[model samples]
Target chain A: MAYELYYWDGIQGRGEFVRLALEEAGAEYIDVARQSGHAMGTGAMLELMKSKHEPHIPFAPPFLKDGDLIVSHVANILFYLGPKLGLAPPDEKLRYVANGLQLTITDLVAEVHDTHHPIATSLYYADQKDEAKARSAAFIKERIPKFLGYFEQVLQQNPGGPTHIVGDKLSHVDLSLFQVIEGLRYAFPKAMKTYMSNYPGLTALRDTVGKRPNIAAYLRSDRRLAFNEDGIFRHYPELDLAP
Target chain B: MAYELYYWDGIQGRGEFVRLALEEAGAEYIDVARQSGHAMGTGAMLELMKSKHEPHIPFAPPFLKDGDLIVSHVANILFYLGPKLGLAPPDEKLRYVANGLQLTITDLVAEVHDTHHPIATSLYYADQKDEAKARSAAFIKERIPKFLGYFEQVLQQNPGGPTHIVGDKLSHVDLSLFQVIEGLRYAFPKAMKTYMSNYPGLTALRDTVGKRPNIAAYLRSDRRLAFNEDGIFRHYPELDLAP
Candidate 1:
C-alpha cells in the first residue's frame, strides 16, 4: 500500500519537507488531507493529534501515516524516510551526519517561525509585531550568518567538493538545504542577498540540488504549493532587513 | 570505543536527555565537557561547534561524538541510541511511535524553555522578564494542560498498562517523560500541583519510571546534574502560578 501523509491541506509548512522527499524519490504516497471529499483536512489532522487511542500522537501537523505507523516532526519523518527512499547514505556514519544536518535545518525552521511569532505561537502576529521585529533583526544579522556559515564550513570540509553537504552523494540534507535557501531567499530576500556571496559552497549546493531532474520537475509541477503569509516562511516587507 | 557526549558541563539542560538514556542502558560514554583537566570543556566544545566542517555541524549542544559519527539534537541522538542500545521497540511501527513521542517531548521542552526565554534565545531572562511573565502565564495555563493531557491520553491508550509510553518494554520515551515530569515539577511546582492530579496515567508513568533501578540509581549518582537557571527548565517564582 502507498504511504499516507497527513498534514494541513493548504500551505507548504513542515509537511513540504516530507512531500519533497517523496516526490523526489517517486515514492507512492497519498496527501490525505488534500484529497477531494475526504474528511481529512486540518480538522482531521488536529483531531488525530488529540487522539486518545494513539499512544504516540504528534503535537502538531506534518505527521506521516505508513500503514500502522504514525510519525511526526519533520526531521523524525525524514530520518525514517531517508533510509527507505535511498535519500540517505548507506553507511551508518553518513546517515547520522545527514540526520545531524536535518536537525540543524529544524533549528533554522524554528528560527524562521520565530521571526513572525516571537512572543507566542497562539498570539496573533499583530499582537507581537514589535517583538517579532527585534527577533527577526537578530535572526537576519546573527542567526542567518551562523547557520549558513556552518553549512559553508560543512561543504568545504566534505573533501568531495562544494556540491553535497555530506560526501559525494545527494542526501536528504541537500534537499533540506535547498529548501532552507529557497525559503530564506523568499522570506528575507534582502538579508539573504547581503550574506549569500559569503557562502559560495552553500550557494553551489543549493543550486545543484535545485537542478536535480526530480527536484527541478517537482518545482515546476502543479503539486508544488506556493509560499504565502500562512506558511512558516512568510515574506513581509516590514520584516525584511535593510539592504 | 565509548561514545563522547559533548555539551555544557554545568546544567542538565538538553544534554541530560541523552545522558539519562546512556546511563539507563549502561553504555560506555564520557560527558566530555564535564571532565576536569580534559581539554573538552565548554571552551573546547565551543571551538568544535565553530569548526568549519564538511557536514554541517549542530547549531547547539547535546551532540554526541560516536567514533566518526557526530550526532546532535537531543531527539536525533535518542533516535540513534534507541535502536542501538536496545531501548526502542523491535517493530518498525513501534519504533516510529517511540520517535513520534520523543518529538512530542521536544515540543513540550520548547514550551518549557519559552516560559523563561520568550523574547529570544540570545537575550537574557532579565531583558525579557515582562514578556516572559505573560508568556509563562499562558504556558502554565494552556501548554501545560495540552501537553500533559496528551501524554496522559497516550498512557491511557498504551494497551500495556500505565507502566510505559510505548509497549510492554521501557523505551527511551518513558525516560524522557520521567525527565519532563521532573523538570515540570522543578519549574512549576504550584501550577503542577494544581493540574498534575488530572493526569493520573502520566503521573503513574512518571512514578513507575522513577522507580526503575537504573534511573533511580542514576538520579542519586553525581552523573545526574542538578537543574538550574541556565537550563531549559528553570524555577523562577515570578513565573510560577499560584495553586
Candidate 2:
C-alpha cells in the first residue's frame, strides 16, 4: 500500500520535509490532505487527528501512515522511512547521527516559527509585530548563525567528506538541510544575503540537493507548495533584518 | 562503563527529562557537567561540544555519550537509551510511538520556555516581561489545556490502558510526561489548579510515576534539581493566571 501523508493542505509546512524524502526515493505515497474527492482533503486529516480510535494520536499534522502504523514528528517519520527509502546511511550508528541532525533542524524550524509569532499564535501577526521584530532581530543575529554554522562545520568535518551530511550517502538529513536553507533564504533574504556567504559548505549542499533529478522535477511540480506567510517560514519585510 | 550525560549543571531544563528516564531505570550514568575533577565539569562538556574531532558534535547540551557514540536531543537520547535501560516498550513499533509522544513533550517544553522569554532567549525575562505576559496568558488559556488534554486522551485511549503512555511497559514517555506535569504545576499553579481536574488520566499517571521506588528516591536525592526561574518552567505570579 502507498504511504498516506496527513498534513494541512496549502503551504508546504512540515510536510514538505517528508515529501522531499519520498520524492527523492521515488516512493509511492499519497498527499492525503491535498487530494480532492470523498474521504479526502483536510477534513480527513483533521478527522484522523481527532479520531479516538487511533491508538497513536499525533499532537499535530505531517504524520505518515505506513500500512496500519502511524509515524508522527518530522524527524521520527524520517528516521522510520530513511532506511526503507534508501535515503539513510548504511551504518546503523550513522543513522542515529542522521536522526540527531534532523532533530537539530527541527529545533531551528521551531525557532523560525516563533520569529513571526512571538507573542501568541492565537494573536494576529499585526498585534504581535513588535515582539516579532525583537525576536526576529535576535534570531537573525544569533540563532541562524549558531545553527547554520554548526551544520556547516559538521558538513565540512564529515568523515565521508563534505559531499553529504552523514557517511558518503545523500541522506534525508541533506534533503531537510536543503529545504531549511531554501526556507531561510526565502524568509530572510536580507539577513541570509549577508550570512549565506559565510557557510560555503552548506551552500554547496543546498545546490546539490536542489539539482538532484527527482528534487529538481518535484520543485517544478504542482505538488510542491510555495512558501507563504501561513507556513513555518514566512516572509514579512519588517521582520527580515540585515545580518 | 557509565553513560556520560552532558547538560548545564544548575537547571533541570531539558536534561531532567533524560534524568527521569535514567533514574527510573536505575541506570549508572555520570552527570559530567555537574561532576568536580580534572577532565570533568562544564568546561570538559564545552570542550567536547567544540571538539574538532567529534564527527557528531551535538548542536546543544543534554547530549549523552555512550562509549564513543554521542546522542543529542532529549527525545533522541531517550530513544537510544530506552531499550538498553529497559525503559521502553518491548515492541519495536511501539518504540516509535513512544518517541513520537516524547517529541510532542519536547514541543510543549519549548513552548513553556517561550512563556518566560517570548521576545528572545538572549534577553533577560525582565527585558521582555510584557511579551512574556501576553505569551503566557495564551499558553495558560490555550496551549496548556490543548497539549495536556491531548496527552490525557492518548493515555486513556492507550491499548495497554491508561497505566502507561505506550504499550503495557513503563517507558521513557511516561517519565517525560511525569516531568511535564510536575513542571507545569510548578510553573502555573493557578492555571493548572483548574486545568488539572480535566486531565485525571495524566494526573494519575504523574502520581503513579512519582510513587515508583527509583523515582521517589531520585526526587529526595540531591541529584534532582529544584525548579527555579533559570529552568524551562518558571513561576512568575503575573504569568500564572487563572484558567
Candidate 3:
C-alpha cells in the first residue's frame, strides 16, 4: 500500500520536506488533503487537528500515515521515512547523525517561521511585520551565518566528499539542506545572495540535490507547488536584503 | 553504561525533560555539563555547539550522549530514551501516541519560552517585555486552554484510567506531563490556579506521577534542581496572571 501524506491541500509549507523525500525516492504516496474527493479539505484538516476523538492529534500539518503508523513533526516523520525510503545510511551511528542533522533543519525551519511570526503564530504576517523586520534582521545577520557555517564545517570534515551532509551518499539531511537553501533564497533573496558565496560547499550540495534525477523530475512535475504567501517560506521584498 | 546527558550546568531548562525520565526510570546517567573537571562548561558547550566537526550539531542543549550515540532536542532525546528506559509502551502504535504527546509537550514548551522572549531569543526579556506581555496574555487566554484541553481529552479517552497519557502503564509522556504541570505552576501560579481545578484528571495524573517511588525519591534528592529565573519556566509576577 502507498504511504498517505495528510497536509494542507495547497502550498508546500512543512509538508514539502516530506514531499522532497518521497519524490527523491520515487515512492508511492498520496497527498490526501490535496485530493478533490474522498479526502478532507483544509477545513477538515483544521477540524481533525482540533478533534477531541483523536487525542493523539498532530499540533500541525505535515503528518504522514503509513499503514497504521501516524507520524508528525518534520524530523520525527523523516526519521521513520529515511530508512524505509533508502535515503538514510544503513549504519546506526550514521542514521543518528542524519537524524541529528534533520533536527537542526527543524531548528532552521522554526527560525524561518519565527522571522515572519515572531509574536504569535495566531497573528497575521502584517500584524507582526515590524517585529518580523527586527527578528529577520537578526536571523539574517547571526542565525543564517551560524547555521550555514556549521553545515559548511560538517561538509569539510566529512571523510566522504563535501557533496553530502552525512556521508558520501545522499541522505535526508542533504535534501533538507537543499530545501533550506531554496527556502532562504525564496524568502530572503538579497540576503541569501549576499551570503551565498560564503558557503560554496552548501551551494554545490544544493545544486547537486536539485539536479538528482528523481528530484529534478519531481520539480518539473505538477505535484510540486509554488512558494506563496500562504507557505512557511514566503518571498517578501522588504524581508530580503540587497546583495 | 550510563547515559551521558550534556546540557548547561545550572538550570533545569530543556534538559529537565530528559532528566525527569532518567530519574523516574531509576536509570544511571551522568549530567555531563554539571560535572566539574570532567565535562565541558558553558563556554565549552557554546563552542561545541558552534564546532564544525558535526554538520548535524544540535541547535540548542539537552543533547544525550549514550555510548557513541549523541541525540538532541528534548522530544527526540525522550524518543530515544523512552524505550531504552522501559518508559515507552511495547507496541509500535502506542509508541507513536506517546511520541505525539511528547511533541505536543515540545510545542507547549516552545510557547512558554516565547512568553518571555516573544520577539527573539537573542533579545533580553526586558527588551521584549511589552511584546511578551501581549504574547503571555494570549498564551494564558488561548494557548493554555487549547493544550490543557487536549491533554484532558487524552486522559478521558484513555481506555485505561485517566492516570496515564498513553495507556495503563507509565510512559515518558506521563513524566513529561508531570514536569509540564510543575513548570506551569511555577511559572504561572496565579493563572494556573484558576484552571487547575477544571482538569482534575490531568492534575490526578500529575499528582500520581509525582508520587511514584522513584520520582519521589529523585525529587527529594539533591540531584533534582530547583526551578529558578535561569530556567525556561521563569516566574515573573508581571508576566503571570492572578487566580
Candidate 4:
C-alpha cells in the first residue's frame, strides 16, 4: 500500500525532510494535505493532529501512516522509513549513527527557524525584526559555520569516504543534509558563499544528492515547494551576510 | 559492562535525560565526565568530541559508550537505551509512541534553552536579556501552555488511564516529562504557578515518578545534579511570569 504522508499543504517546512527521502527511494506515497478532492485534504490533516480518536497522537503535522502504523517527528519518521525504503545501512551500528546524524540535522533545522522567529512563533517577522536581525547576525556568523563545519568533519571522517554521510551508499541523512544545504543556501546565499568554499566535502555531497536521478526529477517537478518567507528558510536580505 | 556516559561535568543539561532513565532503572553506568581521577574525565569528554578517530562522531557531548557502541543526541540515546534499561514497553507500537513523546520532550527542552539564548548560544544571557524577555513571555504565555496542554491531553487519553504516558508501565517519556516539569518549575516557578493546579494529570504523574523507589533515591543522592542557571532551564526572575 502507498504510504500516507500528512503535512501542511503550502510550504516544505519540516515535512520536506520526509518528502526528500520518500522521493529519493522512489517510494509510493501521497502528500495528503496537498491533494485535491480527497478524504485526506488539509482539513483532514489538521483533524488527525487535533483528534484524540487516533490510535497514536501527533502533536503536529508531518506524520506518516504506513499500513496500520503511524509515525511523527522528522527524525523519527525518517528512522522508521529509512530501512524500509532502503535508504539506510543494514548494520545496526551504522543505522543508529544515521539516526544520530538525522537528529543533528533536526537541530540545525530548528536553529534555522529561530533565525527568523527569534522572539516568538506567534509574532510576525515585522514585530520582531530587530531581535531577528541580531539573532540572524549571530546565526550567520557563528552557528552556520559551527553546524556546517561539524557536518564537514562528519563527512571527512566517513569510513566509506567523503561522499555519503554514513557508510558508502546514500542514506536518509545524505538526503536531509542536501535539504539543509539547499535551505541554507536559499536563506543565506551571502553567508553560504564562503561555506561552499570552506566545506568542499559537504558541497560535494549536496551536489551528489542533487544529481541523483529520483531527486533530480523531484527537484525539477512542480511538487517540490519553493523556500519562502513563510517557511523555515526565509531569504530576507538582512539575514544574509558575506564573508 | 557498565555504560560510559560523557557529558559536561557540572550541569545536568541534556545528559540528565539519559541519567534519569538509568537512575530510574537502577542500571550500572558511570557519568564519566562528572567523576574524578579516571580516564573518563572532563578532559577526555572534550577529547572524544573533538577526535575524528572514534567509530562514531558526536557533534557535542552527552554521548554514551556501551561496549564498543557509541550513541549521541538525548532522544536518540534514549531510543537506544530504552528497551535495554527496561524503561520502554516491549510492544513495538507503544515503544515507537513513547519515542515520539520523548522527541517531543526534546523539542520542549530546546525551547527552554532558547528562552535564555534566543539570539545565540554564544552570546551571554545578559547580552540578550531583551530578546530573552520577549522570548520567555511568548514561551510562558503560549508555548508552555500549548505543550503542557498537549501532554495533559495525552495523559487523559491513555487507555490504561492517566498513570503513564505510553502504556501502563513507566517509560522514559514519563521520566523525561517529570524532568521537564522540574526544570520548568525551577526556571519559571512564578510562571508555572498555575501549572500545578491546571495540569493535574501531569503534576500527578510527576509526583508518582518522584516517589518511585529508585527515582526517590537517585534524587536524594549526589548523582542527581541540581537545577541551575548554567543548564538549559535557567531561572532569570525577569523571564518568569505570573499567569
Q: Which residue runs does candidate 2 get wrong by more than 4 Å? A: none
Give the number of the best model, judged by TM-score.
2
**In candidate 2, residue A27 scores what lDDT?**
97
lDDT of 1 by residue, B1-243 (tens): 999999888899888899889988999998989876655677878877877642446668989888766888888899888898889988867877788788788878887887798767788999989888878888887788888887887787887666788888889999899899999999999999998889888888788888878889999998888889999999999998864
Q: Tens digit of lDDT per residue, candidate 3, span B1-243? A: 988787987788889899999998889998877776644566666666676664456667878877756687788888778888999988767776787778788878988988898777788889989888878887888888888988888788776667788878999999998999999999999889999888998999998988999999998989889999878899999989763
Question: Candidate 2, residues B202-241: lDDT per residue as tens digits?
Answer: 9899999999999999999999999999999999999889
For model 3, state the Cα shift of residue B227 in Å. 1.4
**Model 2 misses residue B129 by how many Å?**
0.3
Error of 1 at A129 (Å): 1.0
Deviation in Å, model 3, residue A48 alpha carbon:
3.7
TM-score of chain B of 4: 0.97
CA lDDT, candidate 4, residue A112: 90
Using lDDT, give the best candidate's number: 2
Best-fitting candidate, scored by DockQ: 2
What candidate 3 gets wrong by more than 4 Å, as runs, is: A50-55, B43-47, B50-57, B159-161
| Local lDDT at A243 for model 2 | 80
TM-score of chain B of each: 0.96, 0.99, 0.95, 0.97
lDDT of each: 0.84, 0.93, 0.83, 0.89
In candidate 1, position A168 carries an lDDT of: 78
Sum up the clashes in candidate 1.
Answer: 2
| Candidate 4, pairs of clashing residues | none
Q: After superposition, how far is residue B91 of candidate 2 from its true place, in Å?
A: 1.1
TM-score of each: 0.95, 0.99, 0.94, 0.98
RMSD each, Å: 1.9, 0.8, 2.2, 1.1
